[model samples]
Target: MALLREEDRQYLENLFKENLKDKVKIILFSDKAAGSKLVVPGRVECPYCQQTREILEELVSLSDKLELEIHDFLTDEIIAKKYNVDKIPAILFEKNNNVLGVRYFGIPSGYEFSSLIEDILDISRGETQLSPTTKAFLATVNKPVHIQVFVTPTCPYCPRAVRLAHQFAMENPLITADMIEAIEFPHLAEKYNVTGVPKTIINEKVEIEGAVPENIFLEYFKSALKD
Candidate 1:
């Protein structure tokens, strides 16, 4: 009684194959009983939840380079608390005690799926394709940079912003990037004044709306560093 349809499974298999070419470990935190906490009533089962698990398990079984770990949030309170995971299906990519990248909420599916794969590649390679100038600027950054990018599922340009923020977080241990679904996290959207898609809030001070190139993103990072 798997949730995934055959077509979806095949599609996901192809995606996993294309994305995971090197060793990558995915730690998936989920609760069998609890639905997505971000959703209301807390009783509705996510249609994609079980299917996502199946897809990850299939990828793990087929690929020697990919390792998948699942934890029930109800049974593993300690681990969940340690990771400070408040959302369901949080994906963490770690290597050698260093948290290379984290997807705070759910799977980055739909158009964001490509962004998720890019994140895996970046973590696996231990490098991002950001320009040298961007790297040089980020290298001098010492303080914690928390970036929250608000996006919708249908937005085409949102992934670029999320990827850039994730790249920053992956390169710098002090940087943490969160991809917030505006509709899913309504309160957060209101709190951050997110009236448009791809709104990026850095360290609660500097805010940039719309998708921009890497250099523009770097400029905002620099401004946030000063605050």
Candidate 2:
């Protein structure tokens, strides 16, 4: 059985035909067993890895410009280390074989699905939908910044925050943004003290608790540099 509904598949087919431009490569890393040395002890088996793969397969089928590459989390240790992926069900987007900083550490379902679509379009076009002010601010960022947005798939507001962070990555090569599903990565949720959804941790220090606007997000982005 396909994870995507017939209507949804049609919608995506139309969307890709109209919006997708250049070839977009989606690299996925997953394993049947979720536990790894980096994950918390006794962590639950990856509840969404199979579903995530299904979704990617469906998505790639919608467009000729989209392609999927699957890798095992444990067996492909060398490749995972090269991309710095420490978790299963991780996704990395690329264009013309050049990987970008946009990443997802969990299944991008529910509202986060749109984030994945927009990211594909942005990467294909080699641009973003961010405001000029935000782009200007990102240009001043000379050092590396890591942004981790903890979310649940059902959270309605989480995708905005995730997309905002990803767009920031599109603006600057120094920015790396990830959308991490809180339920799949319990240890990460505890480490970041994520009691609420859409919690964004910048540079593992500056924290924002909601889906704030671009201006406010940039403020926190600047603050994270200081930490």
Q: Could you say which candidate leads in TM-score?
A: 2
Candidate 1 residue-wise lDDT, 1-227, digit = tens:
55457786677667657765557778777766544446535343444556557656765665566788787765787987887666666677777556554564655666776776678777766788999888887787788888988888788999999999999988788888988777766778899899999899999999999999998889888888884
lDDT (CA) per prediction:
0.75, 0.89
The Cα error of candidate 1 at residue 176, in Å, is: 1.0
On lDDT, the candidate that comes out on top is: 2
lDDT of 1 at 36: 42
lDDT of 2 by residue, 10-45 (tens): 998998899887899999998745434465554436
| Model 2 spans with C-alpha error above 4 angstroms | 32-44
Lowest lDDT 10-mer window, candidate 2?
35-44
